[model samples]
Target: NAGVTQTPKFRILKIGQSMTLQCTQDMNHNYMYWYRQDPGMGLKLIYYSVGAGITDKGEVPNGYNVSRSTTEDFPLRLELAAPSQTSVYFCASGRQGAEAFFGQGTRLTVV
Candidate 1:
C-alpha cells in the first residue's frame, strides 16, 4: 500500500495565486500532518489532524488551511500565496512517538 503520497512534486506559484497539495495514506493511520521545510531548515508543522473531520493548526498555519474528510486524505490549501510561502511541503502520517512516513514533498517557489 502507498504509505503517503503528495501530488505535483514541484510547483512555481506567482504571488497571490492559490493551490492545494494533496496527501493520502493507505496505512489507515489516525494522525496526519502537513509541514514545510525551508531551504536547509527543519520541518515546521502547518496543520495536522488526529482523524477524519478533526483538524488543528500547528506551528505555522498562516496563509494555509487544511481539511481531513476521510481516513486517508489530508489536503493543505495555500491561499493568496506569497514569496514567504516558498518552501518544501511534506505530508506525514504516523502514531504518536512512532516513525512518521513522509511524502516525497512538493517544492513550491512563489515569485
Candidate 2:
C-alpha cells in the first residue's frame, strides 16, 4: 500500500493563483504533516494534524491552510501563491515519536 501520496508532482503558478496540494496516506497513521524544503535549508513544518478533526499551525502557516477530517488524508491549501512559497513540499505520516514516511514530494514554483 502507498504510505503517502501527493498529487501533481510539479506545478507552476502565477503570482496570485491558488491551489490545493493533495496528500493521502494508506498506512492508517494517526499523525500527518506538511513540510517545505527550500534550497539548502532543512525541512520547515508548515502544518500538522494529530488526528481526524484536529489540526495545528506549524512554523510557517501564513498563506496556507490544512485540514484532517480523516486519518488517511491531510491536504494543504495555498492561497495567493507567492514566490516565497516556492519550494519542494513533502507530505509525511507516522505515529507519534516515530520515523515518518514521506511522499515523493510536490515541486511548486510561483512567479
In the range 40-64, model 1's lDDT, one tens digit per residue, is 9999999999989999999999899
- Residue 24's lDDT within candidate 2 is 95
TM-score, model 2 to reference: 0.97
Q: After TM-score superposition, what is the CA distance of residue 34 in candidate 1 from its true location, in Å?
A: 0.5
Per model, state how many residue pairs clash. Answer: 0, 0
How does each model score on lDDT? 0.94, 0.94
Which residue pairs overlap in candidate 2's backbone?
none
